[model samples]
Target: MQDALAAHPVWVIVVDYILGAIMWTLIGRAAMNIFLPEDSNFFFMRFFVRATDPVLRLFRPITPGFLIDFLVPIYVAWFFFMIRFYLMPWLLGYSVMGMLSFPLESEIAALLYQAFNR
Candidate 1:
């Protein structure tokens, strides 16, 4: 797995993690929107809303009006999910790798490499 990552430029791994984090944040923001009151003044809620709204807004024009407000976040999450899960792997030439496993393996490998060398 490390070899696969090493075969690519460093930016691919960086982008993969960034995209994954954004996907989860979008999902989290969507959930907050669903369960919490719109007026909820929680700091994280505001942060999520501020961070995600622009990205969600990009899709707003194509989204059907009748789909309900909550779906917008979910739709945005799915869009990023597709990019992270499908497009990125192919573009990075790791299409055969498992999405979740590769990252875990990379982390574990790094730890092992560090422990043994140091």
Candidate 2:
């Protein structure tokens, strides 16, 4: 497991960056929606909504309205958090013990991993 990650560290970094970006985008979109009108054409707000809407739409049906209103982004973030922290490591051929023992050397991946895995 260590050798695989060490050999192809780029893959792990890419996966972690992509997941972290999406998670933060969802969070940003939710925050923007609080103050700005959903239809607001602000550049960043529009970007966030455009970037995150598809994922949020997919999650919508599973969540109740009350939870969806404020907690939807958080739920989506948590999903990605799980994927980045737990699923990816496991899928990368690391065992449970290996996961706990292997140190993530990529700084960005390591930071996000700590944020989520904890």
Candidate 3:
């Protein structure tokens, strides 16, 4: 696992971090929508809406019209998840298709493990 982390360039890690953040944020937005109205004016809700708007808009053309408005974030987040899980590994020249590609989460888990074990 350490060797896999060391093999990637810094930029690959940065890209993975960014994509993972977006993916999680979009999912968070979807989850939050369950408890609050879209126009609730709450800080975190507003942040989620503002941060994810552009991404949703970019995907609007491909997004299905039949989907409820609040469910859109999950739909769009799925694309980011796919890119991170599948495309990143291919870009990094991984010959195997099922290898883990989430460096950001992996690094976080490793850090947490070390912190808890000590």
Among the numbered candidates, top TM-score falls to 3
lDDT of 1 by residue, 55-117 (tens): 877888977789878777787778877776677778867665654444534676678999999
Task: Quote the positional error of residue 70 for candidate 2 in Å.
Answer: 2.7
Model 2 over residues 1-118: C-alpha lDDT tens digits?
4443565477776666678788878889889988886679899888988888899888877766767566788888888877766787688785443332323335545677889997
Global CA lDDT of candidate 1, please? 0.73
Q: Which candidate do you rate higher for lDDT, 1 or 2?
A: 1
lDDT of candidates 1 onward, in order = 0.73, 0.72, 0.86
Please provide TM-scores, in order, for all candidate models, with all chains considered together.
Answer: 0.72, 0.66, 0.86
At residue 90, candidate 1 shows an lDDT of: 84
Ranking the candidates on TM-score from highest down gives 3, 1, 2
Compute the lDDT of residue 99 as modeled in candidate 2: 38
Q: Judged by lDDT, which candidate is best? A: 3
TM-score, structure 3 vs. true: 0.86
lDDT measured at residue 12 in model 3 versus the true structure, 0 to 100: 80
The full ranking of all candidates by lDDT, starting with the best, is 3, 1, 2
